[model samples]
Target: MEGFLQLLLNGTALGSIYALIALGYTMVYGILRLINFAHGDIVMVGAYAGLFTALAVNGPAHPDLFHFFIVLLAAMAVSALLGLFIERFAYRPLRNFPRLNLLITAVGVSLLLENLGQVVFGATPRVFPDIMPSMNWFQFGQVAITNQQVTVFGTSLFLMVVLEWIVLKTKLGRAMRAVSYSHEIASLVGIPTDKIISFTFAVGSALAAAAGILVCISYPKVDPLMGVMIGLKAFVAAVLGGIGSIRGAVVGGFLMGIAESMVVGYGSSTYRDALAFAILILILLFKPAGLFGKYQPEKV
Candidate 1:
């Protein structure tokens, strides 16, 4: 029972990070119906941003709460700008072209980012700073929870709630939904469709940045190619929940995390990575639309 509880806590914490990244995937797909393959690379960039920020403000040895928040904001800001730049320069021009063109462009952008990252950040892995002070928050029998886990989970939940509010309560959200339903109609109704799309990209990228930082907090390592595999898994989580459904992304993330944790605890660590792909295959074969996704017929 204690072992199960420990796995559950760990899984929830890890799932929150996946949910944060998955939210970005769902949002972009919901609005533009294009999978931004480069989105994952943004996570690597954000982690680097946080690393530099921490180094600039204070050395990694001293963990300060204020410095941590500053680093987080800096990373988010840089990521948001990168996302906006990608959307405006890479995607906007090809918007009217066939979606296949956009898809290929996305793949190209992803490769470019990965190669650029290797060149800029180097292929070597760097140690992420200890931003949050470490301490145990809970202990019961053989189960223990740390401050890092609490912070990761709490921050993720807060961000998710804020995102939900933005989508469901704000005027900006209403415009976003309008654009999602029909871009042409939304433009005709006087909504700034282009700006809305750019904003969506910015927001999504920021969430990815936060996830990147949180992951480093938990794992304490960063590399230029770090985002590749985790990004793919987050993409799976989004698909599992329904590509365009925000709530579905969160649920799918938790489910994937728990499943992975259980497998590792009760089974073999070697199969951990393969498990995600296996679930992806099953989900695709059985229910491609995902748990909360609705099947939409493509217009001829």
Candidate 2:
């Protein structure tokens, strides 16, 4: 029972990180209906930002929260701006083209970003600084958890809350909804569809950046390929939650995280990934729209 509880808490923490990254995937999908395969690579770039942050401040420079926040902001800002640029340069021209063209472009962008990261950040693994102290908040029975886990879970939840509020309340959120539901109608109603799309990418990228930072804290390693599994897992989370549903993203993220953790806990950790996909396959076959997604009639 104690072991089960430990697994649960650990899974919840993992799920929170997945949820954060999955939110980015779902948000972009909701607005543009574009997969943005490069989205994961953006997370990788953010990790590089954080690694540099750790080196600069916590390394020889002496540690400070101000410096930490600056690095975090820089990472997020760079990612958001890059997302905006990708939408403009790579996707805008193909907006009127077939969805396949856009899909191929997304794959291209993903590859480009991955390779660019490899070239710039190098293939070497980098270590992140110890931001959280090793104090346990409280012990439940025989289980133990550190401040880092609490920080990761807490920060991810806070971001999720802020995003959910923005989407459900703000005027810009309404405009985004309008554009997403039907671009032609949104534009007819005087909404700037192009701008809305750009904003969506920026918001999604920022979320991905935060996820990157949090994952770094959890795993304490950063490399060019770091975002691959997280990105794939996040994409699965988005699919499980109904690709366009924001609430679904959060639900799917936490669920997938727990599921994956349980697999690792009970079985060979090497098969952990396969277990995740096996579950995803079951979900796809049984409920194609996912837990939070709705089944829409195909339009001819």
Candidate 3:
């Protein structure tokens, strides 16, 4: 029982990170119907941004709360700008073209970002500065909980709540939902569809940035390619929960994380990565629309 509880706690922390990243995927897809494959790379970019900011502010040592906030904000800001740039330059012109074109362009942009990351950040992995002070917060029998896990889970939940508020309560969120429902209708209704789309990308990218930092806090490693596997898994989580459903993304992410943790604890770590793809396949076969996704009939 203690062992089970331990795995559950660890899974929840990891899942929250995946949830953060998956939210970006779901939000963009909900609004634009574009996968924005480059979204994952934005995580890498954000990690690098946070790393540099941390170094600039406190060198290699752990950061105080204020400095940590600064580092987080810097990463979010940089990633948000990059998201805007991608939407403006890479996606805008091709918007009216076939979706296949946009898809291909997204892939191209993803590759470009990965290669550029390799070139800019170098292929070598860098140690992410410890921004949050580490200590055990609680322990029971054989189960233990650390400050890092609490921070990751707490921070992620807070951000998710904020995002929920923005989507459901804010004027910008209303406009976003309107645009997501129907771009042509939203534009006709005097909503700035373009601006809304750009904002969606920005917000999603910022969340991804937060996820990147949270991952670094726990794992303490940064690399240009680090986002690849994690990003794929998050994408699976989005799909599993229902690609366009916010609630679904969160549920799917936790499920994926928990599943991974259970497998690692009770089974072999060798199959950990394969678990995501397996879940994807099962979800696709049994419920293509996902646990929270509703199917919409195409108008002919």
Candidate 4:
């Protein structure tokens, strides 16, 4: 029972991170129907930003709440700008081009970011600074919960709720939904479709940045190439939960995290990734629209 509880706690924390990243994926897809492959690298940028913040502040020591929040906000702000830049410069000019062109551009941008990150940040992995103090808050039998875990879970949930509120209750959210449903109609109705799309990218990137920072807190490692695998997993989670569905992304992320954790607990760690892919395939075959996704038919 204790083992089960421990796994559950760990899985929830992992799921929270995945969900954060997946929200970015889903948000971008929802708005533009384009998969920004570079999205993950934006998270990488955020990790580095956080790393820089830590190094500049005190190096290696745990940060107090004020400094930690500053670092988190800095990462998010930088990442958001990066995202806006990608959308404005790379994607906006090619808005009328074929989607294949956009897809290729996304891949190219991803590669460019990776190389740039390597050049600027170095390829060697850096130790993520201890921002939050690691103090155990409580224990259930053999399962010990710490301050870091609470912080990760709490912050993730707060952001998710805020995102949900923005998407559901705000006027901007209505415009976003309108654009997602039909950009032409949305534009006709006076919605600034282009601006809305840019906002989507910025918001998504901020979420990814937040995820990167939180993951660093949990695992305490940062590298230029770190976002690749996790990004793929988050993409898979978005698909699994139903792409374009915010709620679905969150659910899928949690499910993916729990499944991965279970596989690691019971099976070989080497197969953990294989298991995730296998599950994706199975989900695709059985329900391509995902558990919560609805299939839409397009006019020829």
Tell me how far the alpha carbon of residue 115 in candidate 2 is from the true structure, in angstroms, after superposition.
1.4
- Compose the digit string of candidate 2's lDDT tens values, residues 1-300: 888888889999989988888888888777777888988989988878767766766632644446556667777888898889999999999999998999999999988888887898788887777655557887877897867688778888988988878888999989988988999999999999999999989988888998888888788888898888889898898888878898999989989898888888887799877866886798899998888888998999
Clashes of each: 0, 0, 0, 0
Q: Quick one: RMSD of model 2? A: 1.6
Candidate number with greatest lDDT: 3
The order by descending TM-score is 1, 3, 4, 2
Query: For candidate 1, lDDT tens digit of each residue in 92-205?
Result: 999999999999999999999999999988999999879989999888888999999998898899999999999999999999999989999999999999999999999999
Which one wins by lDDT: 2 or 3?
3
Error of 4 at 242 (Å): 0.2
| Tens digit per residue, CA lDDT, model 3, 1-300 | 999999999999999999999999999999878888998999999999999999898845755667778888999999999999999999999988999999999999999999999998899999998888877899899999988899889989999999999999999999999999999999999999999999999999999999999999989999999888889999999999999999999999999999999999999999999999999999999999999999888897
Model 4 spans with C-alpha error above 4 angstroms: 59-62
Cα-based lDDT at residue 282, candidate 1: 94
**lDDT rank, highest first?**
3, 1, 4, 2
Prediction 2 global C-alpha lDDT: 0.84
